[model samples]
Target chain A: MTTIDSPPPPTLRADSLQAIGVEDMGVRYDLRFTKKTTIRRSVGQILGRGSQEPFWALRHVSLRVVHGESLAVIGPNGAGKSTLLQVLAGIIRPSEGAVDVRGHVSGLLTLGAGFDRELSGRDNILLGGAFLGLEDEVTRRLLPSIIEYAELGDFIDAPIKTYSSGMRARLGFAIATSVDPDILLLDEVLATGDANFRAKSKARVIEIVRAAKAVVLVTHDMSWVTEYSNRAVLIEKGRLIMEGDPAEVVALHRQHTDEARAASAAAATAAGLDPGIAGQGRR
Target chain B: MSVTSEVPAAFRNAADDPGAARLIREGLADIVSRRRLVRYLVQADMRKRGADTILGNFWWVLDPLLQMLVYVIFVTIVVSRKTPDYPLFIFAAILPWKWFTTSVVDATSAVASQDRLIKQIQFPKLVLPVATTTAGVVGFAFGLIPLAGLMLFYADRISPFLLLVPLIAVVQYVFTLAFSILLAAGNVFFRDLGNVARHVLRLWWFLSPGLYSLAVLDEVHVVQANPILKVIANANPFAILFEAYRKVIYGAPTSPPGLPDWTSLAVLLLVSVGFLALSTVVFKRLEPSFAKVL
Candidate 1:
């Protein structure tokens, strides 16, 4: 038997890159306000100089996805997982760092970003496909499959505003996955859809990943991470705290949460906020 | 390069290269693609809005007709007396001026309003202003059909110079695009641009002869010190185009009863092009920040 080297040669699911590469990237978002003298910012200005300051959404976060690699970004709320995905999708700009992506990226942060509420589901699918950078010819070819996959049935001709939020998610997912983007960024998208549709969507996503060049799955679902990801990264605050086998990293994260909680409590107290504030916040 | 490095002179120098060729090729392609999406979005929006009113699409015609009637009453009854066949003159000038002013105002807020979309998409930011302006142009076109019918009844004479309507429309559209881009880009950082635009447009209207005939101001010193305003009043594409409409419809001189100075038209075109080039550079340089601020 030939000796296998280089960490099992990174499973190749496509003819092209079996992995996607991301260099040392940093993203800084300048949340520029129109200088409105709000009570909050006004107080800050009175207390300190430089009335405005930029919020760093992502700071020097970098990871690589092998063509056919599945990576899960597991983090607490506001840990910048979605921001990393947005940077990868090129939707959000990085003020300081650079991101060099190898293939097309389809992001699933909001299911309805491309859907016009006024348009019919059919029209919206075509529009969504076009918005995702699909050519008219490509959309025309994929129309039937996209509609069928959405499971929208006769409702495809009905106005999308009439569709439930779940239905919209299904439609958006179908349209996005139809193109087989080289790299996929899924941000808590699996949480949407009914049980029956959820299973189907998961199967479809699996099918996509089976053929996809790379995928970065950002979700709070630990089970999904364990089941789907070959590699897992846990980000705390703005930095990566752990990375390795999904199960081992998650176990380590669970063990370290007590320490993390203590630090957060101390920091919260220092900042004059309740220690239990974020915990009491929305899930 | 590390973020801590000093501002390198070489890199800073590259910022002033004008970047016209790269912008024309890459920027235009990106803009054209985004414009396609904008077209679809506008179509969907129009359908939704058109279906909301009780009269369905007829409101497009009625809205302008009603406005023309108001302007007619205001101009003939309240303001200018020299507007011969005042109703027809007002109707002729109303549609184009409405097109220019509304389009500019609408385009000023176009990008600012779509802050969510701009922040989430990497396509050219110019698409929003251009799309808003296009929507205004389309609305103006819809309003023109009824105006043409009014012209047939009130002002029956016709002239060949009427062909300038489309050419002048192009000039106005290009000029609006340049202004909209500048204003829209500026508004991204300065929230007061919208307010400034309203007053500026009001001032521009007074200077453009949209409500008054240029013949009334032949000897005014304001016309001498500000020839562009004077030319804007007389050969102002909006005024000149409507004057062309008046000539085609009422056998009147197309432009203040004098030969239009080709130099002014050339100058307007040059100024518009200059503003456009300037706005493109500024917009591109600022684009990296749009997704964050917007």
Candidate 2:
């Protein structure tokens, strides 16, 4: 029923939709101990010989998030979910392949990760806002809204160290979400807050997912994955093992976890060790 | 539901780490574009420092003033030196020396100290050292308050040449920045650089013409015997900077102040500007691995 003269919406363009793209990217860490080497010796080391081992944190993983879509990344601890988000946020350079993010990305890589505890929450908000590429005046104009979002009350003017851990996470979420970023990357940012804040933050994330050009979130919350995300990615041992509807990806993730647990239990029996004791420790 | 695997033409590819030329060009470009941000960070850093003390920013003025007094006392009574207007002479060097030392110490730890921020945020990490170095400018300006008062004590020493203080300082700032970005990047790999930097800076200050003028160095038999030693002494950036500072601030005890060796300073500026470019490239080359290491 639209007239031929009516122009196409800007959202229909591929440029707007291709908010983030990664192609077969990998990250490798030099697994050597941090040895004290002087400038000359290090230059020599860089020139050629090295006995250090390398570990790949992410390998052969291609991912993309277009506008108007939110992808949930569900993976076991140490499965490189955080690393993938960092890569998309352009914090970590990939060792192989390419990554392209189309917009100003606001990544909550670690909740309240950069706050200087000695400074006031207000000061940290300004600092965080600057780090997010917001001008000082812009951050100042947005201050009331951010403070309101955190609901820290007078505590907003207090040093961050005095605030409880939950308060810190709340402030982090508030500052991170202050800007309506084109791409939003969240890494278990809602895991720490109390039930009320978690509910509120979850609702906020849902709203952002609808508004932001693209969003990538890493979470262990199974219900959240199935209920909220347009798609889910399952990462295992530094690889994207599955990607599909949230329900199916979550199913595969659970199945893999169960199998891995069973295998560990079987190995514990072979070693004549108590599975209860061993599993209780690390896992 | 559809996701384009192709990287849009507008999207920058991270796989291609830039060459040295581009790294230097882009590094400077980033600094220019983010100059306002650098100012904000510098102010934040100064505010953080001010929050830690009773006197706070006042110390910036007082610390140098007190140090000048101590040096005056030592030189006149303890050492028995007859350097004229000793307070003005030493203060001239002390003021710039404090700026240099603090800039070095701060920049050395700038990257490693912000491990959390570097890990979490994606802004230019170079801003840390640049901001830290720039913060010294504020402290230096505050130090000048005492410099003004000290100049009043030796009223005869003040001259029109005093205005050249900023011009000489601009060269010193460039030299300090070259050292800063290099040290900041190196410190990430070698955390001990933080401690090593302080000791090296102390030795550097003494080696410079801070405590003694170049004319005094020329009087020493060892310096006079070898032309190469004289050449090396003159080659020091501080040798040029301190001499330039002395010309405008202290002047000769016998005659009025004269213009500094402009040729030397111009040469130093050019060298520093080139070194800064090289350092920026080194910094950008190491930047990608900073998040991983930190």
Residue B6 Cα positional deviation in candidate 1, in Å, after optimal superposition: 34
What TM-score does the predicted chain A of each candidate obtain versus native chain A? 0.80, 0.85
lDDT by residue for model 1 (B183-236), tens = 777777666778878997787766765566566676778877776866546645
Q: lDDT by residue for model 1 over A76-134, one digit each (tens)?
A: 78888877776776666555545556666666666667566778998887666556656
Second chain of candidate 2: TM-score? 0.93
Q: Categorize the docking of model 1.
A: incorrect
| Residue-by-residue lDDT tens digits, candidate 2, B74-136 | 878887979878878888999999999999999998988888887787778888899999999
Model 1, total clashes? 6
Quote the RMSD, in angstroms, for model 2: 5.3
Residue B230, model 2: Cα distance from true site in angstroms = 1.3
